[model samples]
Target: MLKFFYEEIDFKVPQSLKTSKWLKNISLSEGYKLGDLNYIFCSDDYLLEINKQYLEHDYYTDIITFDNSEEEGKLEGDIYVSIDRVKDNAINIGVSFDIELRRVLVHGLLHLIGFEDSDDDLKQQMRAKEDECLLLY
Candidate 1:
């Protein structure tokens, strides 16, 4: 199941049903089943605190994914997204807000599906996979 929440932000995610279907498809395409996945949209400060407390990082990022998969081929986790960052990223990347937001959403799910972007090659592969998944949107 995919759930959406807002923290320290009043923004509403558009097209909830459609986005859910796309996310479920993302899981299935990767040979995994969707589990308890949560997407939390929050302000940059809120996410920064989460980063400092949970990840021990001081920088603000667009999204922070927490892996909670319990078994093989099961995708479960909490994806914390900074709305402020997303807006800035959208302008910087020359994409619309919805497009950047959806990309970040899929990016988090890809991490739960055992995809990592820790290196250049992996980042490229991850981006490619994200593009493929975004097409489903």
Candidate 2:
């Protein structure tokens, strides 16, 4: 089950059904099954509060993912996205808001699939994977 929620934001994911299918395909390609996935879109302030409360990080981030899968090879989690950051990133990266939003969305999913970006090499790999997945979108 893939669901989307909003917090301090009125935006809805465009072409949500298509987005859901594309995400499911990404999971399948990574040898995982889609389970319960939730996307929570919010303002920068709202996400900042969550970051401080849960992660103890005082900085702003584009997304935060919590992996909650109990079964092996199943992807389940809550992905919180900051629309404010996404919009700013889109401008800074010279990409459309839609494209950057999708990138952030899949970045969270990739984390749930065990991809990490804590190091330079891992960050490169993650970016490569993100680009490849973007092409499929």
lDDT winner: 2
Model 1, span 1-137: residue lDDT tens: 89999999989899999999999987898799988999999999999999999999999999999999888888889999999999999999999999999999999998888889999999999999988888889
- Scored against the true structure, residue 31 in model 1 reaches a CA lDDT of 92
Scored against the true structure, residue 135 in model 1 reaches a CA lDDT of 83
Model 2: per-residue lDDT, tens digit, 1-137? 99999999989999999999999999999999989999999999999999999999999999999999999999999999999999999999999999999999999999999999999999999999999999999
Model 1: lDDT of residue 97: 97
In model 2, the worst 10-residue window by lDDT is: 27-36
List the lowest-lDDT window of 10 residues for candidate 1: 68-77
Count of residue pairs whose backbone atoms collide, per candidate: 0, 0
lDDT of 1 at 92: 98
TM-score attained by model 1: 0.97
